[model samples]
Target: MTETQIWALVFVALTFSVYIYIAWRSRVRETRGFFVAEQNVPAIANGAAVAADWMSAASFISMAGLIAFLGSDGSVYLMGWTGGYVLLALLLAPYLRKWGKFTVPEFVGDRFSETVRSVAAVVAIIVSFTYVVGQMAGGGIVFSRFLEIPQAGGVAIAAAVIFTYAVFGGMKGITWTQVAQYTVMIVAYLIPAWAVAHTITGIPVPQVSFGRILEELNALQAEFGLDQYTQAFTARPQLDVFLVTMALMIGTAGLPHVIIRFYTTKSVRGSRWSALWALVFIALLYTTAPAVGAFTKFNLLQGVQGQPVDALPQWVQNWQATGLVSVSESADTITSITNKATVFADGGADLLVNNDILVLASPEIAGLPAPIVGLVAAGGLAAAMSTAAGLLLVISSSVSHDLYFRYVDHHASEARRLGVSRIAMGLAVLVAIYFGINPPAFVAQVVAFAFGLAASTFFPLLVLGVFWKRTNAAGAVSGMLAGLAFTGSYMIHTLEVFGTSAHEYVFGISPEGIGTLGAVVNLVVTIVVSLATRPPSHEVQEMVEQIRYPAEREEVGAN
Candidate 1:
């Protein structure tokens, strides 16, 4: 094996060993332990788990790429994702923890009706499955690139690893495993970013070096006659960006994997504090993303601009061989002596830059050492694996606990439920692996669709159910179905999933932004239906009040 592959394997093996050790130590014996870590995880550890769960492969691998290509427009993901945690902390986390459920669907079922719970469980599965596909695909990319394996092989390995931990350790195991993952991923992300930032501006801190980097980037843009990197807006309409941001924030609040993390914490206060710490851990990477993007882009321009094709750096040739970067000869070429690759060329050997390469290839492009590059590869695996484990656990719990145990056989033994959960988790991992082997779109795009679905279907229901006691089962079910239908249909139409062209859109909103409109429809439909229909029973109203107050939680615990 090559030295790079050897180093990558060492890093991957060490990280995997740590995860397995944690999982082995935290093995569970009962259904509650499997589903919610027996509700005993400390605040700091739960915070790290939440961070690992929330910052998935998309955040690690694609967010910077999006910023690299979209320029200022990419701020939507940074602001939207981080801001959603604020909503989670203040609006959802403590209330859900106080409500005290093993799964998000359980909360819905208790608050509304069995029918609503089933629907929410199905929605949870769909959203988690969608999200897991991106994580699997991201793992595939990392493995395929660093381990010299096929993408399919990489995905299968990821699935196997996730299955081992999630099936055996359940929430208890995954929570501690995620703490380790968060540490690895954050370190991996910041090292190259800081190294590149210091190399460019002599500023060791990337977040604080934005002004200097931006100035250098704008100068490079001017030299190449390209659009200024510091421009406030680009060809993408500003309204569309705003709507996408809104959808992401709402979706983040509603994601089942994220919501379930709070259930693993010790108390409502732990859940609240965990959310705060998650935001801090997540912000470490989110804040550094733009700096990484800007510096990577600047490096690319500097390396390729006015340089002869044959004289280009080895990194360019290496990535070009992978088909991520390509060169095409100009139609009108000068004498052989003048023929060269130029960023400003109308028809020269213009570089067709794929944005996804920004993060994965950053170490190589910046001439960093092999060990740093291997750490990045390992970091990518941690990101994908951490999120995949969380997604798979949620899917497993929704099937075994919510659907099977709650609906099919309520009297099943704890051991039986645990067996079912492990089996369900394995099956879910297989399904995600299949999708990863044949993805429909880019990892980030697929993840965005998952977010849109979550925003449209779950966010409104959970929010209204907690805050508005009058939201009966009929209204909640109707709102969820309406939002899902509208959002799903619009996504299908806009994405041309059925091969139908989209000639018109409501206010020209893209599929990514349609969730906001669907959310509005959900709220209006729910309010109107609640008014027309009977209010919830007095007992249910009391439960809502109990959820709103921490002191009443003792009564709930007694149950």
Candidate 2:
């Protein structure tokens, strides 16, 4: 194997060893321990776990590339994701903790009805599974590049690692493992970013250096006859950008895996504080992303602009061989060294560059040392694997805890429940691996679908369930179904799943941005349906009131 490949394997092995040790140490015997860490995790540790879980491969690998190419328009991801944590802290986390549920569907089931619970469980599975596919695809990319394996092989390796800890140790094991992963991923992300920032502007702090980098980038883009990176809106329309950002922000609060993190905290206060800490950790990366994107773009333009394809740098050649970067000649002359348009843009350009390769290739593009390159690989793996594990747990819990244990055999023993959870987790991992092997689109694109779905189906229900005591089970169920149907149909139509273009999108919103509309649809449907139906029973309203007041609750133990 090459030196880079060997270093990657060594880092992967060392990280996996640490995760295994933590999982083994935190092994649980009861269903409560397996599902929610016995609600004993400290606030800070839970915060780090939430950070690791929230920032998936999309944030680590693709966000910078999107910012690099889309320029100011890419701030949608930055603002949407980080801003969502604020929504979580203010609107969701503490109240959910006070309710003290193992899974999101359990809360829905209690507040609404068993029927609504079943619907919520199905929504959770769909959202979690869609999200897991993206994480696995991200892991596959890291493995394919660093470990010199096929994408399928990389996905299988990730599946095995996640299955080992997630299936065996459950949430208790996964929580501690996530804390370690948060450390690895953040360090991995910051090191190369700092290196690149220092190289470009003599600044060590990437977030602080971003302004200086943007100034330089503006001058460079003008010189190259391209659009300015500092422009407020470049590739996408401003309204669409705003809508997409809103969807992402609301979607963050709606994501099932992220919501479940609060369930592991020791108390309602811990859950609230945990959201703050989670954002602090997440911001460490999110704030640096634009800097990474800007600097990487500046570096690439300096190296490849006006340079002949035959005389391109060794890194370009290596990337070209991976099929992420391609060169085409027209009349024996190379026109463009890299295409900056979206990957899904119609009519493929001559020099097609995959945005996903931006971060992975940034170290080499900056001419960094081999060790740093290897570290980037490890960081990407940590990001992808951490998210995959969290998503798998969400899917497993929905199936085993919500559907199987709750509905199949409510009288089953704890041991039986734990066994069913492990089996469900294993099956979920297999399904995710299969989808990873044959991904529907780019990693970030698939993840956007997950966010949109979550925003549409869950965000409205959760927000109104807590804030509006009049929201009945019928309204919640109808609203969820309407949102899912509209969003799914819109996606199918826009994505051209039926081999014909419907092109009936509202206000020119892309599939990624449609979640906001879906959320709106859900809200309207909920209000209309609730007005037509009877209000929630007094007991349900009392439960909502209890969750609202943290001081009125007693700590309930597992049955």
Top candidate by lDDT: 2
Q: Clashing pairs in model 2?
A: none
lDDT of each: 0.86, 0.87
Give me the runs in candidate 1 sitting further than 4 Å from their true place.
329-349, 498-506, 552-559
lDDT of 2 at 454: 94
Question: What's the lDDT of the predicted structure labeled candidate 2?
Answer: 0.87
lDDT of 1 by residue, 1-559 (tens): 8677788899999999898888888888998889999999999889899999999999998889778767788888999898989889988999999989799999999999999999999999999988998999899888888897889999998778777778889998899899999999999999999999889889989898867878778877667666678786673577888898899999999999999999988888898889988898899999999989888888877887777667777777766655666665652311111112244255533566666667988988999988998899999999999999999999999998889887678888878888889999888888898999998777888898888989988999999999999999999999999999999999888775556776566676888888888898998898899889999999999999988877544565585
Q: What does the lDDT read for residue 394 in candidate 1?
A: 91
RMSD of each: 3.9, 3.2
Please give the distance, in angstroms, between residue 327's alpha carbon in candidate 1 and its true position after superposition.
Answer: 2.1
Decoy 1 TM-score against native:
0.94
Model 1: lDDT of residue 283: 92
Clashes in each model (backbone N, CA, C under 3 Å)?
0, 0
